[model samples]
Target: MRNINEGENESKRSPQSIVREVIQGGQSVMSADARADARFVESESVIAENILSILCVPLIIKERIAGAIYVDHRQARHLFSQKDLNFLEAFADQAAIAIENARLYEELEEARTRLSLENESLRREVLVEKHLDSVVGQSEAVAKIQFSIRKAASGNSTVLLRGESGSGKGLVARIIHNVSPRRNGPFIKFNCAALPETLAESELFGHEKGAFTGADRRKLGRFELANNGTIFLDEIGKVTLAIQAKLLRVVEDKEFERVGGTQTIKTDVKIIAATNLDIERAIDQGTFREDLYYRLNIIPLVMPPLRDRKDDIPLLAEHFIRKICRDLGIETKHLEPGVLDLFVRYNWPGNIRELEATLHRAIVMSNGDTITRNDFYGLFGDIVPASPDAGPVPMPGSLLNPVIGKMDITSDIYDEVMSSVDRQLIERALESSGGRIREAARRLGLAR
Candidate 1:
């Protein structure tokens, strides 16, 4: 029963009321006539509300009184009984359980959210480390390139990577995107040279259903897939003039329509274009548009050739050796004494790519744990000459003159002459170095 004067009743039923007594005593209180009961007769709320009957029971959970349930009736005395109090107490027990369960569920949800955020942070850390490790080098050129990568990642401007083939331009492009603000977004890569001219436009901008002869379904383009992220266009210099014009509109306006579609799709993608071909020369020949070149050249990064950074050869070799060995499921191998010296002296025409391929071949051909100089013999075409003290080695052309027309017709003359020259050269170096193999390799300019 509710009090007619609730505010005044609350003030009157403080420390010495029926509900308060049940809570403190942890027991039930049933009054047949609350207005005349000795315990509530002096209470102002009981007399003012003319309460005839009252029942109050403490809600107990684990021997603790959480609260009290109070019921009363003014029209009739002895309205509530022991049976009603018993039912309410049982219901309070289930209510308390439900309250505790709801609290636990909230905590579990909070913990799940926290753990998900931490996992995402850890994933980004591992991704950055993997990309940085791929750019293996210790030269000043490499240091400069790393600095440029950081600068390029700081903004949303288009980037142009210029270098020869196999010089790690693609690797650099990925690193830039991984460390940028768009790191959490998608990174889409496209090779312009891989697609034929007839299909280049549709491949780049996608096509609507039935747009062409075999276009059966609608397709999403790389730029659409790379929205709010990055798109790396490899061999951008090879794109034809017709595609270049469409590419210019996307770069400048960030909008394009799919092939044979009227709706213009917009994208917020960062463009990173790379090419081994000289773009300036392509523009001179009217093959590549100059405006598109200028748009992509906002942040240019040049990857140095492996030949120019010779000091990094040993490091690159060690990296590729360990990587290739692990990939092939073989025991780790080390390069022999003279192998690094041989690498430093020769010119790598294919840059870092050739070095890696050569090492892979050497490791596969080698039968032991150590990769010897012989494993790399004839891999770099002609051999380097001996040290200055060992005297000049004859050229293959000059050596062929003395044995001309003297061999049998059935003999492999070229192989026989070159083998003879190699044998003599090794013999002379061995004699000059007092028969010490290590010293002989040094005198032959094959060892440090």
Candidate 2:
């Protein structure tokens, strides 16, 4: 019951009329010496394969014939018998059932795959909405920031965020990365002020085995990890001049060598640096290099401090409340009538960071649904000592006099005060150097 040339030559295929007749009638088709039979006298299959005998059985499923099984015997006379025909009918019924089951299984698998794709798409949409909503407040200040974030996200330029400590600079940096074309890539971050000089270098550029004492194995650096993505260097100004020199090469050339290794590895990365320190002052004092500053400051973005954007305090308070409640699995809570007013009046020395911390504490300590002024003051009252005549909020350089709002001073007086400050600094350096002029100059980081 076989035809060797069935698929090899389309011209040798059985007549379509006979096959269709068997399928439509749900019956069998049999022939002995089909060439001599009048039914297939002019058929191409008979002449091509030199058919001597043929048989076909209809494949039926649920009382309907869906297909047929065909057999041809070219080397024998009267090869097919009634017994053979009956056996072929049973085989065709089993084959039809198997084919239907396989078709049903394929359909089920396709439906499952389609449903899984839809679920994943919905999950991503929800995540993107929640993430963007994290930046609360609709005030002009926040709106401008959103605009800047969107603009920065469209490009691969180096961005330098400048503001007071705890002013949401890190949050803004993350927003920029998420909205950028490199959103799918890694978003690596490093706090330059958190580690010592030795650890800072190794962590930034990675280290090979035996790079230093206790160095057991090779390590990959943040830049390497962030390859083809973005790296956020928080408190960038705190990094030493030595590390800054190596970092400068990455910004310009996009390459670096691992510590204690000679291999010059290359990477494609975008750098976003943030700092609370006065970079210009650091450059003047020789703690930060000017060339490196320019390279990082190509697209400078100044994050507004909490003091300047007090209008958004109420919105921020509610956002934090919702966020804290959701995280702690607690019911949503509200602020008392006077609590928000007091929040706006008191200067936030710690900026948004301090505000979120205060709200988290209030949510935890409060006994009722509404946070009272007492709950808010219990945490921040003594720390700030709220009063109308209180001094301005302390910032990165608040140790010195207020640069923006100071009393009038004549030119001579200003010069005299600066000279006095400079003299005191120089004398202290000389004393520390044991009165050696060259030693004092070196300590002051002066070439002369």
Best by TM-score: 1
> Lowest summed lDDT over 10 consecutive residues: which window, candidate 2?
121-130
Models 1 onward score TM values of 0.60, 0.57
lDDT per residue as tens, model 1, 1-448: 3434444545334224777788888888878888778888688877876778777777776677877767677668877777877787777778667756765765575455435533644553442343565678888998899889999999999999999999988778878988899998877777899988768787678777789899765666777767898888999999988899999999999999989899999999999999998888988989999999999999999989998999999999999898889879999999876568779988898999899899999999987898877687687456556574667555556656556767665568778777887898798776565456898888778855
lDDT, each prediction:
0.80, 0.81
Model 1, position 422, has a per-residue lDDT of 81
| Residue pairs of candidate 1 with colliding backbone atoms | none
Off by over 4 Å in 2: 1-132, 379-448
RMSD of each: 17.9, 20.3
Write one digit per residue (lDDT tens) for candidate 2, span 1-448: 4666545654456667778778888879888778788988777867777888889999888787788998887767688888888889889988989988876765575455434533543453343332455677778888888888887778888999999999988888878887888887767778899999889988788888799898765667778777878899999999998899999999999999989989999988889999999999999999999999999998888888888899999989988888788878999989865466678777888999999899998899888787766776565465444565767545456545675257567768778777887898788777555456798899879888
